[model samples]
Target: MIMLSDWHPDIIEFIISKMQNPRILRYLLENTEDEQIKKAAQDKLKFTPLTAQEQDMYQGIINYKQIPGLGGFSDKIIKEAEEKLRTGGTYSVHNSEFLTGANISVCLTSDFMEAVENDEEYSLRFPDVEKYDEEEMKFYNENWHEIGDVREWEQMGYKVRTYRKMRAKELWNLINVCATYSAEPGIFFIDNANDMTNAKAYGQKVVATNPCGE
Candidate 1:
């Protein structure tokens, strides 16, 4: 066991962030003067029912949901999970302290473009769109991996193209939100990156770049 005195305030706050063990948490709660750490500890005590095992494995599993924008998870599922966790349910958040401080980058392509073209208010929320060159368009077209049935749109005589509007309104929305919260979400032009990567010859798509997008 790491001694309480040996741990820095930040480390103590990190332990508080992962307050799965009430005994250890209570010890920290009594020892620490940080309000945020204390509040986190209190929240854990309020939401989680104490068991002999400390951590509720099954409850954590049932309450699991991925964070949206950060992941491709739907809003509905995340909402349901939040509801569950809100009312005396347990959820395991790996490296929860990372939420406090971590270098995170978000990538988007097709969904962003679609929102900009179709959603009027969404479009007005950000910068104006500009046309991409032929080469850029070709790369944009190959960026997002198509899923589900495309035949229906084709049969209906609808243009089932991906690069019709290469707008960054939705991406801007993400950037703005991150900016508001003082979070770092470095933009990665995944489509262009993938097209230019030497990994293409080896039959690999570069879905994400390095932390610095190098």
Candidate 2:
């Protein structure tokens, strides 16, 4: 057998798309230094049938970015963040029970939280505001510039929406649902996080936090 470990990370990653052996995928996940290989292993594991123990291990890889006791080395709580870098939100996880057990903290903006509460489709990273109402449109146009660099939005001519205040009951209901499943997602004011960050001067904004809220 040509050992998977003998191959380079890039080769192993390419094979990951064609290979289905759980054992080899697990080995790559546990041993690989290249994040591309690690993430590819994770993507394969998501569809491959796993034992209970293996499922737990897979969830750990998904949440590996911010293991509770570990430091902030990875970028985010799920593959969605990784997907953004690779494909620009073309492939994103819509929902997952796995995230509840992944043990990663998530932060949602007011507009996103409201959309989820109303069971409407929305995106913070790849925003589309044309479907929104005039009020929401105005809200986005007024605040989008303050939260992040306005140059990109202006060039795209897409005014990203934000909520001045979210409905309390809707917000609490979302919280309760996550809490019930022990999928505790911490809520933070996007505007507040952006306003307080020193990175604003550098044209960066705080979109999310680490497991420790750093």
Candidate 3:
């Protein structure tokens, strides 16, 4: 027997995850001649997060370890991660509850934060880099040989390098390479047919329900 009753958790999961919630039944009932297409799930707009509440929710989500049973790491890292995210934007990973948890699988090359301080010989590295002003010099000092902030240049008609993990159609390496640096992203991919996830709301954060949704 196929159990067909619509459930609340499933509905909530569907709303946030954007994977399983079916609007087809509603569409059929509303537009087609199917009287038998009764509402499979009750209206879930009520369960949605309010703007202020969502802000607060994102706040706690960025620090998932705060949940009583979800112990993971220090709040400092959570804070740092959030602060960094403020500049970096989402790094995919929108599969659970938060869009950009604390990791990533892919990111634009320019997503790296400008180096505020770095030590490297300028002559052998970039002789032309010396012409820039103090702040630019400091940035060069901080990120020599490192990919130029091609992220911004990407918009200004310059070529940009992107990274990938799986051998799909893309450029650069997958985001895991960031572990080599100290700024890796944690991701949670989602798809309608195969998207059943159980995040404890534990750890320092959970994945985003829908990254682009935000």
How do the residues 1-214 of candidate 1 rate in per-residue lDDT, one tens digit apiece? 1211111123223334433444444554575544554566566553344453433533444344433353555667556545554444553433445444444454444444456577532211111113546664454356423311233224533334432222344234434443344434455555566667898899776655566552
TM-score of each model, paired residue for residue: 0.30, 0.30, 0.15
Assess candidate 1 and give its TM-score to the true structure.
0.30
Q: In angstroms, what RMSD does candidate 2 have relative to the true structure? A: 19.8
- 11-115 per-residue lDDT for model 2 (tens digits): 233334443344455655676554555676677664333456745544555565656743443544356444433332232221333333333333435555566
Alpha-carbon shift of residue 176 in model 3 (angstroms) = 1.4
Stronger candidate by lDDT (1 vs 3): 1
Query: What is residue 69's positional error in candidate 1, in angstroms?
Result: 51
- Write down the TM-score for model 3: 0.15
Residue-level error in angstroms, candidate 1, position 20:
22
Q: lDDT winner among the candidates?
A: 2
Every candidate's lDDT: 0.43, 0.46, 0.30
Error of 3 at 102 (Å): 9.3
Model 2 ranges with Cα > 4 A deviation: 1-97, 104-106, 110-156, 159-168, 180-183
Question: What does the lDDT read for residue 141 in candidate 1?
Answer: 59
Question: 97-129, model 3: which lDDT tens digit per residue?
Answer: 433333223221111211112321111011234
Off by over 4 Å in 3: 1-172, 192-194, 197-214
